[model samples]
Target: MGYQELLQNKQYLFWTLQFVGWSGWAMSFYLGIVMWGRPPDNYGFYLPTIAMIGMTITLGLRWMYHLTWDNGLLTRVVAILGGSYGAAVLWMFSRGVIFYNAFPEERKVYEGGSMSFFSYFDGSVSAFWVMLSWSALYFGIKYYLLMQEERQRSLKAMNMAHEAQLKMLRYQLNPHFLFNTLNAISTLVLDGNNSLANVMVTRLSRFLRYSLDNDPMLRVTVAEEIEALQLYLDIEKVRFDERLRLHFDVDSAASEALMPSLLLQPLVENSIKYAIANAIDGGSIAISASVTGRDLELVVADDGPGLDLRNGRLPKGGGVGLANTRERLKALYGNKQSFRLSTTEPHGLTITIRIPLENTTDSE
Candidate 1:
């Protein structure tokens, strides 16, 4: 069994500890009686006998320890120590009885309450120390294991929360996108452009189908994300015609980088809403991506009026799009990714995003 699995098996741990402890006790007894020529007893008989008795007594103590294992801290301290000392006293008395019976002649030679009593008391103290040590180790390991399990549970909860947040962010884009497209279709129908309206409706259906096909948590390649954004732009293009000039400047190396599904749509939609929709002569929306080191840098820039920095209020660009994008990036990459907005040198606003370059499908 693995170390963690073995540590969790109380039965196995108890028996293993009992065997090692009693073996050590037997070795000490042999050293004193045989090697040092002290006590001068029959080592062969006494060693195995004492070891077996020690193992049996500790086994009973092990059962008692388990009974009080799950109690409150104070109660456990009292119960375990009390049980250990009681078991020690009982074991010492039993050993004395056995030794007396085994060596009747030696017992008869001993005077009343002298060497015999001291020896028995010494054994009781030894047993008490051993049991005390065992209790400390048992509780220590149990608490460590409990803490590990608790940590695992906490991480699981955090991941669930992250996923819920991601879903919420993904959902936020849908309603805003739908409202704009429906309004566009309404405008086209009112202007007697039925063919364009019909085409826009078809593109909208395809875009929605693509969004529905991919899960919110699915990690998509940069190429796939771009395709989905293109579907969205197609619907908008029909309404604006030559006025909406869309450009893609994605590098071939960065095209395979993995990202959250439909991550860039909101940025593009924001550009259309704040830039293209406001301009009578239309504007240019550019989406570009490049790889540097282990990072993928993406920028969505549009030529528009840009943000008004004079007044306290910012531009209409920083709406649900910026907020949702920022939240999603935080949820997915934590502190590893960056998203920022800045006005272009001459005109328009630019949204820059930097994320880790996870190129392989399995890397995600």
Candidate 2:
């Protein structure tokens, strides 16, 4: 059973252990008497009576221990030791009363109604150890369970924080992409292309609707993602006209693979901003997806003035899209995913990502 279930139903656990412990003690005492080759005529009755009395005394101890649970360590320790010793004395006195009444001729060590200090003391010596052991086990189990409960709470909090961070990263993309699209539409309006501006506005509304309707926390199939990307490209197409070129090379097997929703939108936006929008002749952007073994690989490459690699690294500034994409991937897949930036062959910049391959069927 899980610790959660055990901790939740502590009353049942206590009762079960209480019954088992006292019953086992009774059985052992009976066996020991039998080994000595001389048992009282009413041993069965006598033994059960003594065990029930011991259980009653321990129940009282359990109540006292619970009452002092929040007390200082020294106070609790004193309560345990004092409670066990006192319980042992009461148990022995009860055992003596029952024994003398059950078999009056057996011995004169304890008189039924007499109070003898030495008689109770001698019997309490052995009983003390049994009560002490019970107390130790009760506290040991209680503390262990409390520790497990604390650990469970910590883990739950951490998972909540992790999910919140992922959502923050996902939300960052929408406004950045929205601003750039609105600027492009503004440019069209300035150039006096009212007809094209109307078309772009229609497409922009559809794209924004798609973005808002779907939750950022959900995953989408590669085909679905590509369709959304087309909505975005349509808006950009009106701005660049034929100067902007696009090509998709998604494999049939990889099209149904699942990835975070809108994961590639920022990367595409980066290509349009840096590569296609800069040069006089514009440039082409290629997006491809393929599955190899257990991994799904995606590539976005643009043919334009690539990164200024004089210092063998990308130039600073204008990297929000790439950086945001990287952080989002890391948040989603942790160490199980990879994102790499490299210079494309001949020219341009390329971003490659590999994540664990998961399909719709696999997720279900």
Candidate 3:
């Protein structure tokens, strides 16, 4: 999505492959010349061939690293170091042919260094040094690559966990609402309220369609949310008759606001189940929505018995009340939104949910 992300992604792979190929080429070419005792003509021809051989092996190591290994710094280091060590050993043995046919002049090649380096650095000795040097470099590159991959994997896993927690929170609210709405429909049917029951059944079908069709990357408009809420409330209407009244005072601009899917239906279901369904004379639910700056604030309030107030007491609708709502808000908005609850007026509980809409793209 950003420059840094691209660098850490496909570009990183490209650069790593280039680094490995060129490094091994340089290593093999120089080693080939040293092994040949600086042969005048064949030296150039054999060095390029050796470079190609070295690169072929390095590319294989890279492929294995990308596809099979854990893609962690440690695994990359082990694979490259181990693989290149084997390659170097093979190269050394091939060049060790020069060691058996030794002469005074051949050893002189390693003697020119300022440290008064001996012929011990020539022929087989020189081959060993080149092989081991490339091996060490292989290990270092692999280690760094694996570390980068491990970090990226950790971040992806964390995001997955966060998204799962959000889905669970949203799901938890569903069964409670299901049980309550079904109970209301049952009561209406038993009392022979056919017209109301049919209406509620239609609303229930539409409500379910929205609930079950949620996608992870899309936000639902505010209008869609309120429509689903009204559908759920329609079922409550049949059960409560005149006693359950709902008032929606939503700003015209707020109706187009974007939010995580399935947000409003849960809050509205909680209001009906805990407030209107549990109230002695039933109750009224008032929904007020407004767009404040780039954020949307929605308040679902009701006049009913105050919070259970008793410590450790679960609310009437199987504790799916504010807890699930809070979790869903957290999952969808992370720490960027708020779901505030308080009691107001003579017989009411009010919940104020605020969510930013400027970057509503990530909500689902």
Candidate 4:
């Protein structure tokens, strides 16, 4: 426990105390009749009254000491001292004129005087049990709180590890995309298309700047991802010219939606390489998104050469980005999200990605 907690809980430790003097109990209004009307001799004495009072004081003092000192050696040492408190109080009552005159005590009450030693024993044993039970309950509560804190700490560490993996994977893109775009840029420059080459270089610069500066695990809005993809297409437009075209129909509802860092780049690159690259006149690529309950259903489609379903295989190193994106969804949203692939109408390829909206925590 912290320092403040100990102080606040002290009221729980030291509050209520019961007082029983002689004849086991007392009442102010009836006190006159109880003591004055009893028979003579030992029956007139108050011994049970003394025993009860002794026990109360002894137990209370021992309880207070246990919480304050809290030492094993001192505990045993103080125990030797506990019964003495009761014994001294019992001794005073046996000799004191006040105890005999106050309460109307029976034969059994007088006999309790002979067994005053038993009161000492009862008080000492009670002190031990009270101290033991209080200590057990206190430590039990503290231990439970410790376990809950430890569990939360573990989950925070796991979340941090997943974030680091995402950031590192986002970094894997530029170098690969750079090499492919540089090849296209070189051809445009060689063909004497200086304006187009400058445009491609500028788009390339913007793409690289976004990849380099933004947080890799950030959830970029769908509008923002489209902007990045358009910049990318602008660079590719320099090389393909009239042969390549793209159709983008983004749903307004899903436009402001969030996505993992560089999530769409790899899928766009995959479609351009395998589908558009093989066609004689290249082709058109379509990107669209729609809301499905608490998730976004997004599709990237291209009208070019399609893959064979029977093979279920990439031509060579064709599936790296798709595989990585698939793994990223699993790491980020687990089973709540989905990724799918299919062949479009007569000759094109289509890839669909579904992400749950609730699990999206990052925003940019």
Task: Decide which is better by lDDT, 2 or 4.
Answer: 2
Which prediction has more favorable lDDT, 1 or 4?
A: 1
lDDT score for residue 67 of model 2: 96
What order do you get sorting by TM-score, best first?
Answer: 2, 1, 3, 4
- Candidate 3 differs from the real structure by a C-alpha RMSD in angstroms, to one decimal, of 7.2
Q: Is candidate 1 or candidate 2 better by lDDT?
A: 2
Q: What is the C-alpha lDDT profile of model 4 across 1-364, one tens digit per residue?
A: 5644543464442232223222233243135545777444443334454445544555564565556555686664454455344445444544344433554453247556664423334444444443344344444544555575687689889889988887666667667788889988888889988887888888899888887777866677788888888888887777677778888888888888887767888888888887777778888889997788988888988877776654433344446787778778888889988887778888777888889763334332
How does model 1 score by TM-score? 0.78
Residues 169-203, model 3: lDDT tens digits: 77767777777778877877999987887788887
Measured with C-alpha atoms, the lDDT of residue 45 in candidate 3 is 50
> What would the per-residue lDDT of candidate 2 be over residues 1-364, giving only the tens digit for each residue?
7756767788888888889989999999889989989897898899888898998899999999989999999999999999999999999888877776787666554444464534656869899999999999999988887887788899889878877887777677778778878898898899998898899999999998998887767899999999999999998898888989999999999999999888888899899988988879999999999998999999999997777654334456748777777888888888999887788879999888999999999988
Flag clash pairs in model 3: 72-146, 73-146, 73-147
TM-score, structure 3 vs. true = 0.66
Ranked candidates (lDDT, high to low): 2, 1, 3, 4
Q: Which 10-residue window of candidate 4 scores lowest in summed lDDT?
A: 14-23
Cα-based lDDT for every prediction: 0.82, 0.87, 0.68, 0.67
**What TM-scores do the predictions have?**
0.78, 0.82, 0.66, 0.64
| Greater-TM-score candidate between 3 and 4 | 3
